[model samples]
Target: MDRKGILAARVSVFIVSICFIAMGIMRNEHFVVFKKAVKICLECIGLG
Candidate 1:
């Protein structure tokens, strides 16, 4: 593919990913992910 087509694909993918992320945030999935990550880190440190 040419440079312009590659750039357009990249932009479209970015926009789609942003929309999915926004949906996840609206559903509060980010907090759930953050909690899981924190739990894993604390367990690794023997704090949980």
Candidate 2:
């Protein structure tokens, strides 16, 4: 992509990430995320 398109893409990624973070914070979803991440990590290590 061109310079402007590249910048827009990067900005969009940041905006979407921020939105998800805000939603998670509002719903206290991040707490559950840790458990899910632990499961994922365990599966990755072939221990799950």
Candidate 3:
């Protein structure tokens, strides 16, 4: 594709991803992910 077409595609994809992230945040999914990450880290270090 041409440069303009590529730019438009990139912008559209970015907007869609931002929307999904916002939706996840609204549902409190970020905290759940953070908790899981912390748990995994603790387990890896034998503290969980």
The number of the candidate with the highest TM-score is 3
Name the candidate, 1 or 2, with the larger lDDT value.
1
Off by over 4 Å in 2: 35-48
Write model 2 residue lDDT over 1-48, tens digit each, in one string: 899999999999999999999999899898898777766586678887
TM-scores, each model vs. reference = 0.70, 0.63, 0.71
lDDT per residue (tens digit) for residues 1-48 in model 1:
999999999999999999999999999999999988865587678886
lDDT of 2 at 29: 94
Worst 10 residues of 1 by lDDT: 36-45
Clashing pairs in 2: none
Q: What range of 10 consecutive residues in model 2 has the weakest lDDT sum?
A: 35-44
Model 1: CA > 4 A from native:
41-48
- Over 1-48, each residue of candidate 3 has an lDDT whose tens digit, in order, gives 999999999999999999999999999999999987866587678887
Ranking by TM-score: 3, 1, 2
